[model samples]
Target chain A: SAVISQKPSRDICQRGTSLTIQCQVDSQVTMMFWYRQQPGQSLTLIATANQGSEATYESGFVIDKFPISRPNLTFSTLTVSNMSPEDSSIYLCSVAPRLGNTQYFGPGTRLTVL
Target chain B: TQLLEQSPQFLSIQEGENLTVYCNSSSVFSSLQWYRQEPGEGPVLLVTVVTGGEVKKLKRLTFQFGDARKDSSLHITAAQPGDTGLYLCAGVGHNNAGNMLTFGGGTRLMVKP
Candidate 1:
């Protein structure tokens, strides 16, 4: 397990405003991922961030809406652009430390777009 | 897209009871993992099973992967109030080794004291 921390544990933002969430890991990792968990729903992958590369987003997600920055291996940021009520969800950051399919997650960022 | 189905989307039981959560999929997974999440927190990895017919135990919790690698089960014995939370099962279907994950609809468990 890894020690992962997310910034702005909870936030209330107005619609059309953008919010940036930061993820920091104690140890440098190779792969970092962002996920969205809707209220009462399971997690859905938003994007996969590898160091020195553009994030690969899932089908339902796009880079324009969720811009990701992975400037290093251990830290990354996800910006929710032009936020709406539908973007009100728990955003989580996770990392895969090894080749095995095990991942450790950080305490999520609870966002509410009013 | 690969889909994983978890049975009994909701489970409510009293302390000292045993419960099992099942995850099934038509597509075979390279590996499967189980996670438990509480409110205001992220999902925590409990265990991961890679081989077919493999079983792993953590204290009172037992996880088993089916022979065909398309299904799995998590059984908890002597459930306690602290065991209440959302249980999720995720699978890696592609051969990229941990690059991607497809999660199943979670099972909400409530163990009342």
Candidate 2:
């Protein structure tokens, strides 16, 4: 399993502002993914971040609202733009070292939009 | 897109009671994993069942994969208050791109002392 960490474990921001969550993995991995969990609900995948390329967003997720960056194998970022109260949720990152697939996750970033 | 349906959306029982949570899907999965999550924290992996009919145990928790590889279950013997949390099951298919996980609706369990 990979040791994953997310910066700014939590934050409170204004509705119109933007917040960027950073994810760092201890080991280099080929696949990294971002997810959103609404209160008392299941996780919804936001996108798959590929190193040195654009992110692949899931259905109903737009790049303009959630811009992702994966500059390298071990690091990625997901920025929530023009945030709204509906956007307040836990943002998590996961990594899978191989294709045979079980993913390890970061602690998660709890975001609150006021 | 594959979907996993989990049953018993909510459960509450005495500390000594036993219970089981089920995850069913029509689509086959290459692997399935169970996780436990507490309040205000990320989920911690409990176990992974890869092969059909596979069973794995950890302490008081037991996980079993269905023979068709499209279903799974988690059973707890002598449930404890410490076992109270959200239980989630995720499935991964062979054709899933980049290790994407299809998560179940989740079962919220509360064991009272």
How accurate locally, in lDDT, is each candidate? Answer: 0.92, 0.91
Model 1 chain B: lowest-lDDT 10 consecutive positions: B92-101
Q: Provide the global lDDT of candidate 2 against the true structure.
A: 0.91
Model 2, range B1-113, lDDT digits (tens) per residue?
Answer: 89999988999999999999999999999889998888877788899999999999999999999999999999999999999999999998633355678899999999999
lDDT tens string, model 2, A23-96?
99999988999999988888889999988988998889999999999999999999999999999899999998
**Candidate 2, DockQ to 2 decimals?**
0.65
Give the per-residue Cα lDDT of candidate 1 at B67. 97
Q: What is the lDDT of residue A97 in candidate 2?
A: 85
- Per-candidate TM-score against the hidden true structure: 0.96, 0.96
- lDDT (tens digit, per residue) of candidate 1 on A1-114: 689999989999999999999999998887899999999999999988868878888888999999999999899999999999999999999998765536889999999999
* Candidate No. with top TM-score: 1
For each candidate in turn, the interface RMSD (Å) is 2.1, 1.5
- Residue B97 of model 1 has an lDDT of 26
Going through the candidates in order, their DockQ values are 0.69, 0.65
